[model samples]
Target: MEKRLLGKTAIITGSARGIGREYALRMAKLGANVVITDIDLSAGKYKETDIKAKSVKEEVELLGVKSLEFEGDGTDESFVKKVVDDTIDTFGSLDILVNNIGGTGGAGPGLATDMEVEKFRRVIDINLTTTFIFSKHAGKVMKVQKSGKIINVASVAGFVPLFVVQPHYSAGKAAVISLTKTMALELAPYGVTVNAIAPGYISTVKWDAHFEAQIEDLVQKVPLGRIGTTEDCSKVIEFLATDLSDYLTGQTIFVDGGLMELNPSSSKIENYQI
Candidate 1:
């Protein structure tokens, strides 16, 4: 809000909607030029944010900062490389990279033993591989500049086991956390900090629409006594994206409402999903 990232450039993946969208808007509010990249730029057709514009890119421009919109598959290495190149060519500097493109890919059976082969692979590619590709290209630019921040979006599922299904999602996120630490060490010499935010029970348009009836029940399990908002997740990204976290690297900050502290075992909880 104080324009801490003034004149900076941030590229957020899967930011057409959900928590990623919040990250883009937050960066823009801090005076950073935002690049809205997603497989579907029109993905937000399901719901609307408070600041209504023709699109998220428009919303960012409304904040008095430049915005670039690129729609492409996150798993495509060529597309990702182009995004990185084009951002540098236009922005003159790559100050921030938020790897927010990931999901369960809900195509396979949920159980570990019963998980579908293709679905599991797709989940890993979208979450882990996508992160690596962006970091690889973006790191090249950041390393040259000798300053940058990379914030990866992980999930509580990566840290703890769940009674619910979706083993592929869990495994993919766990790998992301590991990758973040590795990248942190690799990029530290270049003054590039790599960190991750693992959120829990965030209420997004798609999540709410799917679990609307179970919202209250899910909140009851959270010690905070409420559902987490996209802003809750984005605020943490803000910290990691700014100088405030300059000293921190190779860290995974959990944005959960103390949900992981419980460390609930599968036997204790019945099919709970985070």
Candidate 2:
């Protein structure tokens, strides 16, 4: 087996669990030392669930790559700066950054009008603002290296409404999509590529916790005839992180089963079967 990212280092935020955890594990197998950051670390309990930074680190190390776990709020500017600095100090180079943090918290299934201002702001911080902070700090190190790959985790909500009611979450993810374009342009000259991955209906253990209801009806809508898996998303990230996607930048990849950017009324296919 060949490793494309041998000796390279990657920083993936919110990697204590779910999609982010998958990224850390996969990247390690691809021979990239992994830096895993998550708010769950700040609480020092992994997560309310069983997945924790320690478990992720152990798995990544088993793949024979160094893994660093930092505990803090990803939305904090100072914390982000420190994390970036520590990455360079420890690994000596920052090769890839996966900004995979964002979600709707306590206030579940909310209409825009019914949401509290504070909650709205909180969602934005978790999703959008944190992306900005990570990208900005990570870009600095990549700029000095004169080469880097930055991948942001947007959502299908960034492009279209989902079955769930999450107005603020949608807005924040859309902003991340926009940020991908702008960052790509800003960092292109520095030999850095910035892109966002918008995923739809990815089924995870975490998803079962809050969004099992979304599964039944949503799978039928996907042209691929099934919901996505975290590995499905990570494989795409693996591509974008490599030089094979060197020409790809300033773009958003919709990792849906052809569910997004579709006009259901005008599709040539009347129905899709698995």
Predicted candidate 1 versus true structure: per-residue lDDT over 88-185, tens digit per residue = 89999999999999986556437777766888899899899999999999998999999999999998888775545767887899999999999999
Give me the displacement of residue 28 in model 2, in angstroms. 0.3
| Model 2 root-mean-square deviation | 4.4
In TM-score terms, candidate 2 sits at 0.91
Writing each residue's lDDT as its tens digit, candidate 2 over 49-138 gives 544334787778988999888989988899999999999999999999999988875556666667789988999889999999999999
* Superposed Cα deviation of residue 81, candidate 1 (Å): 0.5
Model 2: residues with Cα > 4 Å off, grouped in runs: 42-54, 261-274
- Runs in model 1 lying further than 4 Å from the true structure: 49-51, 262-269, 272-274
Count of steric clashes across candidates, in order: 0, 0
- Tell me which residue pairs clash in candidate 2: none
